[model samples]
Target chain A: GESVGLHLPTLSVQEGDNSIINCAYSNSASDYFIWYKQESGKGPQFIIDIRSNMDKRQGQRVTVLLNKTVKHLSLQIAATQPGDSAVYFCAENAGSQGNLIFGKGTKLSVKP
Target chain B: GAGVSQSPSNKVTEKGKDVELRCDPISGHTALYWYRQSLGQGLEFLIYFQGNSAPDKSGLPSDRFSAERTGGSVSTLTIQRTQQEDSAVYLCASSQVGGIQPQHFGDGTRLSIL
Candidate 1:
């Protein structure tokens, strides 16, 4: 079955350092990918998204890179702060079907 | 000015009981989705509604789970004879249109079946 999976389940990063979360997707048909930040006891919030046509997309201090050839996706946070600590999930929209498959999130812990 | 909203922020019921969860999508939004998330797990697509068309129920886990969107606005998810394994957080999200667009999510309803 096609699925989106993450390389790490948990990551600990020091404040002001850069953080990278990786995701691997099996669905080659996916044309759009999105990154979401979910805090404890809250719903997933959209952070940034990139289309298959673009290799990278930037928003605020976050950037999403898509490597279609390798079927890999990544989210990079610059100058990571304590507020940026949350479970980050990568989701892929295979098509216009509105079905988004999400990867098992990476829990990011930023230490001050 | 408002985001998606779900009712019964928390629900606790015994096994074999039935439960209904409601989701109120943002006004004028035509697409709504339901997803389930277990502890320490990722989001699981449950069902999706696009306008007044038939919903894509392929993601529904089993016959015990069902959902419906009325008038292209609100939606309700029903779980029958729920079991302990059904415990999880049910999230509802709405988008201006279906597919490729960013979705605004509700706080979600946490269901605990004991």
Candidate 2:
């Protein structure tokens, strides 16, 4: 079945550094994409999202880049903090129904 | 500032037993969703319900898994004849009218099948 996946299963970064997580999606017809952060014992929290019309979207200290041709999506966190560490998932909405198909997620660990 | 709320944060059941999980979506939210997550993994889509519309149950793992939403506000996912693989965190989310809207998620229910 078609699904989204992450390039890195685990990422370790130092505090105050920048971290980048990458995702590859298979469905070409997807129109919306979103990033979510899940902390331990908690539900997934919305981080950032981008539409097919634009190639990039920026949130507070977070940026999402989309490359439609390659079906690649990335999340960049600036000045990474310990609290920023979590499992990050990228999801794609293929149609107007808004049903999201999620990626396996990448565990991000920040070393202080 | 009320978000989605789920009941019985954690549940422990024996194999072959039945369990029901509940979700209370954000007030006036017209869309509701259910997902299952294994430990250290991504979420698996379960079902979706739009106000007064038929639910999408394409993701239910087997015949034992079922869910229903009443009055477009509360939803319950029922699992019959549970097994060890049924243990996971069940998450529910809600959105505005359209699928283009961002989904707001609840804390989730942790189920452990013994």
Highest DockQ: which candidate?
Answer: 1
Error of 1 at A98 (Å): 1.6
Alpha-carbon RMSD, candidate 2: 1.1
- The DockQ figures for the candidates are 0.82, 0.80
The global Cα lDDT (0 to 1) of model 1 is 0.93
Q: TM-score for every candidate vs. truth?
A: 0.97, 0.97
Q: What is candidate 2's lDDT per residue for B40-89, written digit by digit as tens? A: 88898888889746457788999999888888788899999999999999
**Model 1 chain B weakest 10-residue run by lDDT:** B51-60
Q: Report the error of model 1 at residue A3, Å.
A: 1.0
Mind giving the per-residue lDDT tens digits that candidate 2 earns over A4-106?
9999999999999999999999999898999999999888999999998999999999999999999999999999999998999999985677889999999
Residues A22-88 of candidate 1: C-alpha lDDT, one tens digit per residue:
9999999889999999999999999998889999899999999999999999999999999999999
Positional deviation of B92 in candidate 1, in angstroms?
0.6
